[model samples]
Target: MKRIGMLTQIFIGFVLAIILGVIFGPSIAVVQPLGDLFLRLIKFIVVPLVLASLITGITSLNNVNKLLSLGGKTIVYFLATTFFAVLIGLAAGFILSPGKGVDIALPTESAEKAEAPGITETLLNFIPVNPFESLTNGNILQIIFIAIAIGIAITTVGEKAKPLADFFEALAQVMYKITGFIMKLAPIGIFGILAPIVGNYGLDILLPLLKVILAVAIGCLLQVLVTYSIAVRTLGKMSPLAFIKGIAPAGIVAFTTASSSGTLPVTIKNTQENLAVSKEVSSFVLPLGSTINMDGSAIYQGVAAVFIAQFFGVDLSMGQIVTIAFMAVVVSIGAAGVPGAGLIMLTMVLQSVNLPLEGIALIAAIDRILDMFRTSTNVIGDASAAVVVQHQENKASLAKSA
Candidate 1:
């Protein structure tokens, strides 16, 4: 008898979820607790995993210049690829015209408008007044800041910091063990998580917003298939097919969870095992990308903005379209890497272009469906960045050896 591959089992789980959900309908909600347990297990790993992995990753660097070089390359990769992501998103919007002849009734209550955080305030928030509080609060950006600062300080202290570094390194190993156990439960968790969603979101609810869904789907597909493929190949010097296959597990988890941040551990694990990224690089790049590189959300915001404008019969000016691109890029980079970031980005983009905020209500109805698609894309983009930067680091290491 042949043993089934892990991805194959997961695919089976996904297929079963759809089949059962359709047959059982809303009754499938009963299994949600199984999914919640899995989510809790994963969430339990997130804080400690991030803190320990990042701290060790930094200490391994052993020098500021190397750390700076890695950070610079990671940031540049994010910004450059994001430019193409936004362009692809906009192209999807223009071609699809998703809003044409579609009428979405705004909720009786006004859609809540989201306030964009100021750059200064957002940057300042990164520095945690109490690192323990940040950890307890699960503030990822603050945690990253804490980990980097501590890691850098440890690097400066040399051998004196060895005890602390050893502690974190050990902790990182323990977290990895825990993640492995949790991931074995993935097929079951995925079944539990997806069945209810499939049961709840009937075709009737999804039919009207079908175009909006298609536009976002097409945009995300292009970003992954086109943009990230070229990136991992030309810049990263890896086969695109291999890159896609290596990252598939992370993408599936992201789609089910609809959370790039929550899927960080899987991303790290996939890169290390499947993509050959070093622990040091994956730890830093994947975490930072979770918070900073929101290519998927940017795509959703782009398509939604165009849909809103067209739905209202508002003709978006050339300047407004450019502004949408600018805001999508900036707000995406600036977003706090939380669940509702898509709405926040959309609100800011629409407001900047003088489109009505009420359009948000229409999209909010089918937001979860859109989220599944975007979240998968976001994780894939995150992994691609990890691959590209790690490839650069590998090249640098080879050059040094030579």
Candidate 2:
């Protein structure tokens, strides 16, 4: 019955948002408040949910070594999956040649150069100098580091911090309840977002960059279907079909919202409730994955690099491909946490290789469309990781018991 209510409300919200968007047109500003409010509510919960979940997830572990070992496996899977995604994107972009064009004058826009942080600086930044400041500013990576630190601290204190640990355990459950409550409004938010989206831009907006958009979507599908499924089968040793079925809800939310962080709640709910990943694993991995493991965005970066290069008729050397590969991995870390932020990161990528920023306008029109698909792929990747992580953890526990 509760499930029915959630589904029903989602549908109504979706339908009404579209109707009002079409009817209100420019006046979407009125209902826009509701959508903004919804987004704010989700944003409000992200930090607390991540912190609480991580604290609980890590401290609950009796063996700090197990936590570290699991972390290694999780990261290995993340890097492996993202590397495959990049390859798929590069291949698709090369084949489609979406940048082949007759004529479209580049826009006169100065590219915002990304402040390229050194490898040392990037590594140093992860160790939070001040944890509260990281939380206040919503520096996701820093917050994660802090949470894990606190988790380690709690575990070190052991029996002495049991009460404190229990509090966080309860807090994690409470946060999940809050997430479920907000998700009830998802359909309405989806409709409202789409209505203003479609009303303002119309179908004509898509016609210009349709080819590039389609190519990106195809690349995203390839990553989700090929890379993820293989990871689940060989590494996790799960049936690929079951894994896809498990992560579908997360993919849907991601596709509609285009925000990986925003989709975290749905990802958590689906991973734990529907897919049966342990709360311990889902709680730890999903939040970390949301901020870092962006297979879909990495793919987009690769494909976008090729497309921009093609548009400018600038031949990319093998060295440039290697540079793009390195940059794709780095840019994805920054891109996932920012909503509607992928394009800005893309601009940085093009400028790194001296591609014309003006070509960005060619893809900007279709950015939102591609974002939906990329985001879906991102969440799917996260959910798949959670399932594999949990299955392995369970298998280990059973073996020890035996």
RMSD of each: 1.4, 2.6
Best by lDDT: 1
- lDDT at position 118, candidate 2: 52
lDDT of 1 by residue, 4-91 (tens): 8777777888898889988899999999998898888989999999999999999999998999999999999898878887888888
TM-score of each: 0.97, 0.90
**Model 1, residue 354: C-alpha shift (Å):** 1.1
lDDT of 2 by residue, 123-184 (tens): 78888888889899877778889989889999998999889889988888999999988887
lDDT of 2: 0.78
Estimate candidate 2's RMSD in Å. 2.6
**For model 1, the run of ten residues with the poorest summed lDDT:** 1-10
Task: Give the poorly placed runs of model 1, Cα more than 4 Å off.
Answer: 109-111
CA shift of 110, model 2, Å: 5.6
